[model samples]
Target: MRAGRGLLAALALVLAAPGGLAAADPAAEARAAAESLRAAGNLLSGAEEAKDRVAALTETVRAYEAGLASLRAGLRRATIRERAIARGLEARRQELGQLLGVMLGMERTPEALLLLHPSGPVGTARAGMMLGTVTPALQAEAEILRAELEEIATLRALQEAAAGALADGLAGVQTARTALSQAVAERRELPRRFAASPDALKSLLENSDTLDSFAAGLARDSGQGPAEPGYALPPLPLPVNGTLLRGYGETDAAGISRPGVVLATRPLALVTAPAPATILYRGPLLDYGNVIVLEPAPGILMVFAGLAEVYGATGEVVPAGSPVGLMGGAAPDAAAFLKAATEGGGSSQPETLYIEVREGDTPVDPAGLFELDKD
Candidate 1:
């Protein structure tokens, strides 16, 4: 009976008191993320000459971005689990000492007596009876502890491996972005719209004080795009891979609300055209930062702001998924990335891309116009 109690105590000492096994397999998720990276690497191996090089590299860059995001998420999960287990062990340090004592006592006692627990004839019978129930539980809990420790080790190994892969990923995406930019610059096959009138655009840039005013000017131009009045927008991808920072009508830290959705994009991320659109204007505009104004259909104009570099000339009709610009900011290198992952919080997306849609002259919410990406 006493031995049984000791075993249970030992089990209690090692057993984590918080949540049980996580419902999702973060390791599996990490592996899936790695697979995505591998795919990107394979596609980019000789991507410069692929017939659809521009499109291929575009997808490649996006794949790398999405994969890296997934990897970050997985690393964060693994780190959090490892820390929780460590905290559990640290909290029960004294209990663990007692557990050692129990284990040592078990070693000294006779095997038959260990099971029988010689309290007395009546108590002995009861201990033997309890043994049947208790032994399996002790083994089970010990196995659980072993598994948890192994999980910590696996997580640590994963983070270390991710460092090299993440560095390579960062470099790879940058290379792809550079290639995509050149490809877009050389591209001349896209259909054309009327060239932006420099004097008119220049006047608008100088006179317009707000994004709304600038957008309204560029959109009202008759030759900006094919006039299809009351065009119902189909769900299209957001210009960049990102998470939603602020939705339309959401107030920010400054307590200002806008009729636009703010997306938090990774540094130097590529921004692609969501659909076929004619570039009405592409340059630094008002307070919105580097902006690309596209009239997808007459009466519907989309504005992408906060870019580091803009591609294509005004009046170039770009197809869906065409590279239009790059997001502003600098990404962390591998060392910093791994350090952040090991530290167990998460990575930061420093660049903000503000997207707004105007239907005719009215500023409308853009959230439903684009399919939002969670990663």
Candidate 2:
């Protein structure tokens, strides 16, 4: 009986060791993860807002420059070259009138006014003939006027040429303004995206040493049980409301297993968390566009793909139903991802959303969890 009791005690210790190792508190994991996810989400959210402001400012600067160029062009077009010519012609006409008055002696003697009329009837006819003969003098005056007018015309031409060059310069300034605005916009966008650094995440995933080290610290006080059966796990709230153009699961064009689900929605729609979780990774994968991976619990991970912009960071936690990032097609309404050729003759492209579930190192049917709650 003593030997049997000792053997039973040994067996009990052996069994207890495994349980202790596997023991995890789901609630605690969820809380810790949720906090990380939230931080990641906030970082992303702030970045996105900054991006929007920059974009708007860029557009405004472009518009202002455009209007400025147009105003310059209009001023050029409205300027008159004729005014200069008119002033030159008026001066010449006044000089010719004075010369005629002096030649006719209409400006002196006993009857200066009478000189303009004639001395008598015979003189009147002679004066009339003299006036008619003044055509030669008038012709000479006109020749001088024409020469002066030509000079004025040349000056006017120069003015127009200068205006055209000024207009060109203004156009160049406008182009530079546009380029500068766009550059600033891109510069602003680059830092947020660069700082999060998807490449770092991919590296971490590839060589788990660093991540494992980090995870070790997090796991020190870890309390979570073995993963529960993934059933009726609510489909992650789409960044925006829209139809799912493509369902989860299928061979992609490259003949690779479509790793996750796709949710089709409008451009820039906000993608949110499916459940409380921590961002295990926030970066890009080969086929995934702007990927975000959130671990809700041990053996359960959520992935978001084809993000126009990402809003989360590694080591950040989020609450269930919190905003992850916005969904984006091409514009306000369009699909971002193309469709794979169907087995049937016709082709189908859908705005797709991808989700995946993993248990340890196994890929299970994600549909099971999504389908369970469908009404």
| Predicted structure with the largest TM-score when compared to the true one | 1
Tens digit of per-residue lDDT, candidate 1, span 178-273: 888888888878788767679988988898888888877777664544446656889987788888899888999999998898999778988999
Instruction: Give Cα-based local distance difference scores for all models.
Output: 0.78, 0.43
TM-score of 1: 0.87
Report the lDDT of model 1 for residue 127. 72
The 10-residue segment with the lowest total lDDT in model 1: 15-24
Candidate 2 lDDT tens digits, 111-212: 434434546677767765775576455555445444444444443343343343334333333343344334433442221111224565444446544322
| Candidate 1 to native Cα RMSD, angstroms | 4.1
User: Where does candidate 2 stray beyond 4 Å?
Assistant: 1-202, 205-240, 333-350, 371-375
